[model samples]
Target: MTIASTLRLSLYGVALSAISTLGLIGCSNSSTDTAATTENSSAADAEKPAKSIAITQIVEHPSLDDMRRGIIDELADNGYVEGQNLTVNFQSAQGNTATAGQIAKQFAGDNPDAIVAISTPSAQSIVAATTTIPIIYTAVSDPLGAKLINEDGKPFQSNLTGLSSQLPLEPQLDLLQQIKPEMKTIGYVYSPGEANSVSLRDSLKQALPARDLTLLDIPANRPTDIGMATRSLQGRADIIYTSFDNNVASAFEAMTQAANELKLPIVASDEFSVKRGAAAALGVNDYDFGRTTGKMVYRVLNGEAINNIEPAVMNDLTLYISPKHAKTQGVSLPAELLKNGINVDEQAQSTDNK
Candidate 1:
C-alpha cells in the first residue's frame, strides 16, 4: 500500500468520527428542550385554580336562615369563599309550597354542585325536582316517613343526605304532664300540608294515651284557619300544644291570643314559640342544628362522598318556658322547668293581666 492512500483512509475515518460526535450533541440538546417544556406544562397545570361550586338554599325562615349563614361561614373556612371560589343562590318560598317547588325546579335546572333544603316541604320538593343533584337537608322531621330516605337513614337511591329535626315527642309530652298533672285533655293545632306537623301530631297522639291524657287535634290548612281551629278547642282542652308547624307558627300571635282568652296554657316544640306565648317547651336549639348541618356541608363540598356518611339527628333537646304566660294562665311551672327557661320575663306583665 502506498503512504498517500493510507493517509486518505485515515482522513475518511476522522470525518466519520466527527459526524457521530455532532449527532450525539444534537440529540442531547433536543432531549434537554423536551424536558424543559414538560416541566413548564406541569407548573402551568399546578397554577390553575380548581372548579367553582354552587350551593342553593330553599327558604328564608329564621332557622333556615341561620343554616345558610352556617354553610357560608363553613365554605369560607374551607377555602370556598362566596363570589371568589364559590357561588351561592338562595331563594325563599315565603311559606308557600308551590313557590318552594318552583324554586327547587329552577335550582335543579341550574345544575348546582349541591343543594341544602331547610324544611320538610322544601326537601321533598327538591327531591322531586332532581334526582341527580346532591341534597343536604336541615330542620326536617322523619325523613323516613316523608320518604326522603330509607329506614336506615341512607340516601334514597339519589344523592340525598342531611340532618333531621325529629325532637323527641315523649319528652315534650312528659314535660307537659309534669307541668300540669291534672290536665287530661290537651289541644294540638297543626297544618295539614306540613309533614313535620303530621308526624308530630301522630307522635303526640301515641304519647298522650300512655299518660292517660287525650290530644285534641285541630288541623288547619292555612294561617287563617289556625285561629278557628284553636278556638274550636276552647273549653275542651286544659292546655294547648303547638308544634313547629310553619302555618301555625307564622300566626302564633293569633293562637297565643286565643289561648290567652281561654286561659289555656301553651306547650310548644320550639323556643321561638315558647317566647311567643307557650308556657314551656321541650325542644331543640335550631341554630345549633344549623351549625351542625354546616359541618356536614363542609364534608360534602370537600369531595367526601355523602353515601358513606349516615344521616344525623340533632338531638340536643332544651327546655324553655315563659314565666309571663305561665303566670297569665294561672299555671305554675315547677322549679326544674324554670331552671331551663331561656328568657323569663319576671317584670313584663302578661297580656292576660287586666
Candidate 2:
C-alpha cells in the first residue's frame, strides 16, 4: 500500500515539473521575441540620417546674432533639434568681405543640406559660390537690388529663397526731419562693398534731395574705420544717418562715440543700431526676420522643392528710441515717434560706453 501511494505521488510531481518547464520555455521565447523586435526597431531608427544646416553671416552684431538665434530656436521648435535630429554649423565672417567670400566657398565645398546667409554680403557671396545648394538669406534689405532675385521678381529658379528687410526710406527720412527741422545735409555712413548699404545709399541720395536735404557720402570699408567715417561727417553734414551696413552696425558703438563727441545726432535705418545707441532706429525686427527664414529652411530640408517656396519680404517695421541717446544726440523726439517706439532697455544698457 505504501509503495503504490509513493509511486502515484512521484508521478504527480513529475507532471507538475514538466508543466513548469514548458511554461518557462514559453516565457523565454516570448522574452527573446520582444528583445529582437526592440533591437530591430532601434536599428531602423539609427539608419535614419539627421538633417544638417549651415548658417553663414556677414558679421557678429546684435541684430545678426538675434537672427541666428531665432533661426536655431525655430528649427528646434519645428522638429529639427541641434545634436538630436538636426546639425547646425554656424560661421561668422567677422565684418570682412574677403573672409565672407572665403566662408561662402568653404560652405559650398562642404555642401550641407541647406545654407542660411544672414546679411547682404553673406548672401551675395554664397550666391556666387554655389548654384545647386539650397540657400535662405535674411537681413538683406533689398534682394532685388542686390540681384539675388531675377527679372521675373522671383528667387532664381530653385536655388535660393529668403527674407528681405527692405524698409521704407520715407518714414526714416521724415523722422529725421522731425528730429532736426533745420537739417540741411545728412551725413551718410556706409560700406560701398555691401549691396544692402549701397542700395540704401542710392535711396537716400534720391530721397534726400526731394526733401531739400543734401547727402554727404562717408564710406567705411571695415568696422574699425567707422569712427573716422562718422567723424568726417561732423562739420560737413548737419546730421548723421546710417544705413543697415553690417560693418557700421558691428562697430556702432564707435559711431555713437564719435557722434557724441561731435555733438551730432544720428538716426539709423537699422532699429538694432538705435538700441545700440543711435538716437532713433526704424527698421525690421531682426530676430523675427530670422525666425521667418528658419521656417523656410525647414520646408526645404523636409523635401519641399526650393523653387516652389516664394522669397519672403519683411515689410513689418519696428521703431526703437532711447530717450537718453536722443537727448545726447541733440535730437528732439516727436510725440508720434514715442507712441510707436519699442523700448529696448536691455540692448541700450549693453550699448553704454564700455
Candidate 3:
C-alpha cells in the first residue's frame, strides 16, 4: 500500500474512536438524569401526607342522607377523592342524641383533619367535645341562638364554621295561608330537645300571630313518638307544619300516616320533606346546603383558616309541592303557587310502602 493511503486510514480510525466515546458519554448522562428525576418524584409523593375527615349525622332521614352524599360528591370533584389521597370516616347517630355525643368524642379522639357535623344536635355534640378540631356543620337552623356563632354569624375565636338551613318563618307561614286561606292554627310536630326545632317553634309563635293564626306545639322526644305527637295535633290544629327536626324526620313516615289518617294537610320547612310526603315546602334543599358546606371544607383543606370563614345561611329557596300527598290529605294546591313551584311530585310513594 502507498504511505499516503496508510496515513489517511489512521486518521479515519482516530475519528471513529472519538465519535464512539462521545456517544457512550451522552447515554450515561441521559440515564443519570432519568434516574434522578424518578427519585425526586418518589420523594415528593412520600412527603405528601394523606388527608382525612370525619362526618357525623344525627339520623338517617332522606334530607340528611342527601346532604351526606352531596358532601362526598363535592369533595371528590375538588380532587380530594376518597380512597385515593383522602380518607373519609362517616358515622350516623341513628336518631339518638346520646349516640351522637359518643360519636363526637370518638371522632375528637381520632383528631382527623376535619369533622363535618350534620344537623344541630350533631353539631352541638361535636362543639362540646372539641375546641380545636375544625368543624363544618350543615342543616343547622338558628346558629346564633344555638350558640354556634355570634349574632354576626362569624366563627370568631372559634373553630366553628358552617352553612345554616335557617329558613324564614314568615314566608313559610304565608305559603300555608295561601294553600288553606283559612288556616287558623298552625300545628308543629318536632322534637323539643333539638335546638333547631325549639328555635323554630319559638319563632313560629311570634310569626303566627301576625297572620291572625295560633301555633300548636306538639312534642315528640323520639322517632316512635312522632305519630302520637302528630295525632295530638289532629283535632286542634287547622293544618300540620313540620320543622327540620332530626328525630321527627327519622320517622317522617309516621307523621305522614297520621296526616293521612286524619285527612290533614302538612307543610314542611324542608324541600326533602315535601318530596317524601308533605303536601308542600317553601324551603332549602339540604343537598345544596351540604355542597356549600363541602366547598368550605375544601377551602380548609387547601389551608384556608377556619376562623376566617364566616358562617353562612342558605339564601336560595325552592318551592316543592306534592299533588299526591295533598290529595291524600284532603288539600287542594293553589294553581298560582303551582305555576311558580320549582317542581311538583305527583308520583311519590306512600309512607306505608316506603
Candidate 4:
C-alpha cells in the first residue's frame, strides 16, 4: 500500500515538471520574437535619411548677395536642391544690428542645419544666438578681432568656420604712394562699431608713419555720417582711404561725391568702391569670396565638422582703378597697373565725356 501511493505521487510530480519546462520555452520564444521586431524597426529608422538643412544669411548687400548665390549654386551642383534635399532661409538685416540679432535668433529657433553669416556683425550675432548650430561666415575680416573665433582662427568652442576678407594692406598702401607721391596726409573713414574696421584702422595708422603719411581719422558712426565726414576731410587730406565698412559702403556715393568735389583721390579696400569714386582699390572679387564661402558651406553641410575646417582666404586679388576719379583728382596710376586694372576702361570712357 505505501509503494503504490509513493509511485502515484512521483508520476504527478513528473507531469508538473514537464508542464513548467514547456511554459518556460514558450516564454523564451515570445521574448526573442519581440526583440527581433524591435531590432528590425530600429534598422528601418536608421536607414531613413535625415531632414534637409536650413541656412540663413545675415544681410543682403552686393557682396553678401554674391555669397548667398554662390552657396545656392554649390548646393545645386552637389544635388542638394533648395526645395528637395535642402531648405535655405535667407534674411537681410538691412544694416541693422538689432534686426540681424533677431534674424539670428529666429534662425536658431528653426534649428537650422547651419547658418551662413556674411559679415563680421552678422557672424557675431549668429554666434551669440546659438552655441550648437553650425555657422559659415564670409567677408569677415579678422575673425579673431571680431571675437567670432579664437586667436588661432579656430572655432571658439562651437561650430563656426568661414573665410576672411583680410586682403594684404601693404599692397594697398603702396598703391597710395604710387598714385600720390606727395600725399602727406591720407584721410581714412570707418565705422567704429565694426571690429574689423577698427583693427584695420590701427594697422593703417601704424603703417602710415613709415610711409611718411599721416592717417587722419574720420569717424562716421553710420551711413548718414559718411557724407559729412568726407566733407570734413576735403582740404585736410591729400587722399582718402576707405575700408570695407558696411556703413561707409552703403553711402559710398555720397562720400565719393564729396571727394570728387574736393579733388581728393580715394583708395578703397573693395573694387566696387573704386568703381564708385575711389581712384584705385586692391581687393579680392566679391563673387570669388562668395564662391569660397560656398565651398565651406558644402563641407559643413556634407557631414564635416565645422570646427575641424580651417578658415580660407581668397588666392587672387585684383587691382581696380577709376580713370574718371583719377583724372578729376589729378592722380595717375602706373602703366602696368592700368593694364591690369579690373575696371579702368569703363571708368575712362565714362570720364572722357564728363
Candidate 5:
C-alpha cells in the first residue's frame, strides 16, 4: 500500500463524516422549531374560551321560527358558528306561557353570554329570570308596555336590550283602507293574555277613530278560541285584521278559514300571514328583526354594556299581497298594490300543515 493513497482515503472518510454530522444537526433544529410552533398555536387556541347563548320563543309559528333561524344564521355569518366557538341553545314554549316561564328559569341557570327572547311573553319571562344575563328580545310589538325598555326605547337598566316589531300603524291602516276604501269597521283578533297584543288593541282604539274607522275587538284567550272569536266578527266587521298575537298566530289558519267562509278579507301585521291566506300584510320582516337582534347580541358578547346599546325598532316596511288569497276572501287588491307589493302567488297552506 502506498502512503499518499492511504492518506487520501482517510481524508475522504473524515469529510463524509463531517457532512453527515451537519445534516443531522440541521434536521434537529428544523424539527424543534416546527414542534414549538405547533405547541404555541395549540395554546393560543386553548386560551380562547368558547362563547354560548340561549334563545327562547313563546311559540313555534312561522314568524318566530324565521326569526330564530335568522339569529342563528347571523351569528354564523359573524364567525360565532354553532358547534364551534359559540354554543347556541334554543327552546320553544309550544304556545304555553307557563312553559315559557319554566324554560326561562332553565336558561337563566345555565348563564349564557346572552338570552334571545322571541316574543313579548318569552321576553318578559326571561327578563324576570335574570337581571345579569344580557336579554336580547325581538318580535315584541311594544317594548315599552313589556317594560323591556324605558322612554325613547333605551334599555331600562339591568342587562336588557332588543329590537321591537312595533307595527307602523299609519302604513298598515293605509294598506287596509286601500284594500277597502269603504271599510267602516275593522275587526281585530288578538290575545288579551299577551302584553303586546293588548298594547296593539289599545292603540287601535285611539288610531281608528281618527281615520273614521271603528275597531271591533275580538279577544281570544287560547288558540282554539281564535276561530270562534273571528267568527263572532261576522256581519259586523267589514274586514278582519290580525296582529302578531302568539295565541292567535298559533291557530292563524283557523281564523283565516272562518274569514274565508264569511267572505271577509284579512289585513295582517306579519309578512308570514300573507302566506297563511291573509289578503295583504304590511309589516317588517321578522327575520330581519331577528338578524338586527343578533347584531345587538354580538355587540353584547363582545363586551358592550347592554344598557349602552339603545333599543331599536324595525323600520323598513314590506307589503305582501296574495291575489289568490284576496279573491278567496271576497276582495280584490288594487292594481297599484299588486304592482308595488311583493306578490306571493303560491297557494297558502294551513299553519298545522306547514
Candidate 6:
C-alpha cells in the first residue's frame, strides 16, 4: 500500500525484537541470581552443620532408648542443645528390618548434618545407604561381624565411626555363676538376624565350655515369637542368658514371663534388661556407650574427619540385680553379688530419671 505504512510496520517489528531481547536478558539475570542464592544457602548450611542429626534404632527397647537419650545429652553438654541450637530427628524401626532400611534411605536423602544408628541392623542399613554423609553408630557388638568394619580394624566407609557395646566376658560369667552356683547349661535366646547376637553366641559357645558350662542358644526369628522360643528351652537349659540382641530385648518381658512359668532365671547383658525383668545383667552402661558415640559424632560435626576417628569399644561393665525380678524368675542373687553389684530396683530409679 503506502511506503510510510510499511516504514511504521518495520519500526513496530524492531521495537518488538528489542523488547524480546530485554526480556531474555532479565530472565537470564534472574536465573543466575537464583543459582547464586542456592549456592550460598548450601554453603551456609555446611558452615553451621552441627545443628542437625538424624537418628534411627532397630527397636524401641530400654537400652537403646537410653542410649539415644545419652547421645542427645552428650551433644547438649558440648553446646548442641536441642530446641535451642540443635535439631534432632529420630526414628525407630520397631523390630522390623524393612522399616530400618526405609528410614536409612530417608536419612540419606535428607542429608542431615549427622546420622546416629543405634543397633546393628539400623547401622548396616545406613552404612549401605550413603558413603559421604557422616554416620555414628552405637550399641553395636562385634562391629567386625556386623560388617561395619573391615578385618583391618577400620570403618568400612570413611564417613563411618561408632562405639561398640562389647563388655568383658568374665564379669558376665561370674554373675551367672552367682545366680546359679550349680549351673551346668546357660540357655540363650537370641535373634539370628542380628550380627551382634550371633557373635555373642559364638563367643559364649567357646567361653562357657572352658568353665565346664554349656550354651543352649535358641533362635527367635521374630520379636513376637521370643516367648515361645523361651518356652522351648524348658528341659534343655538350667538358666537363660540373653545378649544385646535387638529382637530378644524388644520382647524381654515376654521371655521373662515364659521363664517364670518354667522357673528359669534370666541373666541379661545390660542393665536396662535387668530393669525390664532379667534376674541380673552385667554389661557396659548403654547410656555411657551412647554418650561416647555422641562424642564421635561431635568430633565429626566439629570438622574432624571421620576417617581420623577410629571405631571404639566401651569395656567398663557394671552388675545390676533386680531381686524383685529375680524372685519372679525363681533365682536368689547371692549375698556377695548383691553387696558388690548395684540393685537395679532401688539404685537404678535415680539413674532412670536422668
Which candidate model has the greater TM-score, 5 or 6? Answer: 5
As a whole number from 0 to 100, the lDDT of residue 147 in candidate 1 is 88
Residues 290-332, candidate 2: write the lDDT tens digits.
7777777877876778887777566555667777788887766
Model 1 clash pairs are none
Q: Which pairs clash in model 5?
A: none
* lDDT per residue as tens, model 1, 1-354: 211122111111212222123111101111256878656544443333343434444334454566567666655544455665567777778778999888888888888777888878888888899887777887787788788888665668557888876665666666777678899998988887888889888887787776789988889988878788888987799888876677887788888888888888888867667767878876677666666676666666657676655677766566677877887776888876666456546524454464
Please provide, for model 5 over 1-354, each residue's C-alpha lDDT reduced to its tens digit, 9 standing for 90 to 100: 211112112111212222122111101111256878656544543444578999999889998998888887666555466785789898999989999999999998999999999999999999889989989888888888988887765677568877776666776777788888898999998888899888888898999988888999988888989999999988999898888888988898999999999999999876789888899887777787677677777677667787776666665567788998899999998887877777766433343457
Q: In candidate 3, what are the lDDT values of residues 1-354, reduced to their tens digit?
A: 211122112111212222122111101111256878656544443344568999999988888999888887666556566785689999999988899999999999999989999888899899999999899998887788778888655663478888876665656777788778887888888898898888888888887776788989988888999999889886798898887888878899999999999988998867778877888887777777677678778777757788877676664667778878888998888886677664556334344457
Candidate 4 lDDT, tens digit per residue, 1-354? 211121111211212222122211101111256878656544543333343454444445465566677767655544455664567777788778898889889888988778888888888888898889888887887888988777665677467777776666667777777788788998988888888889988998898888778889888987889999989986789988886788888888889888888888888867677766778877777775665566667666667787777665553567777777788776777675566677665856789989
lDDT against the true structure, per candidate, is 0.70, 0.76, 0.77, 0.71, 0.79, 0.79
| Model 1 residue 316 CA deviation in Å | 1.2
lDDT of 4: 0.71
Residue 201 lDDT, candidate 1, scale 0-100: 81
Report per-prediction Cα RMSD to one decimal: 24.4, 21.9, 21.4, 24.2, 21.6, 22.4
What is the lDDT, from 0 to 100, of the residue 134 in candidate 6?
93
Residue 261 Cα positional deviation in candidate 4, in Å, after optimal superposition: 0.7
- Where's the lowest-lDDT run of ten residues in candidate 3? 22-31
RMSD of 4: 24.2
Clashes of 2: 0
Rank by lDDT, descending?
6, 5, 3, 2, 4, 1
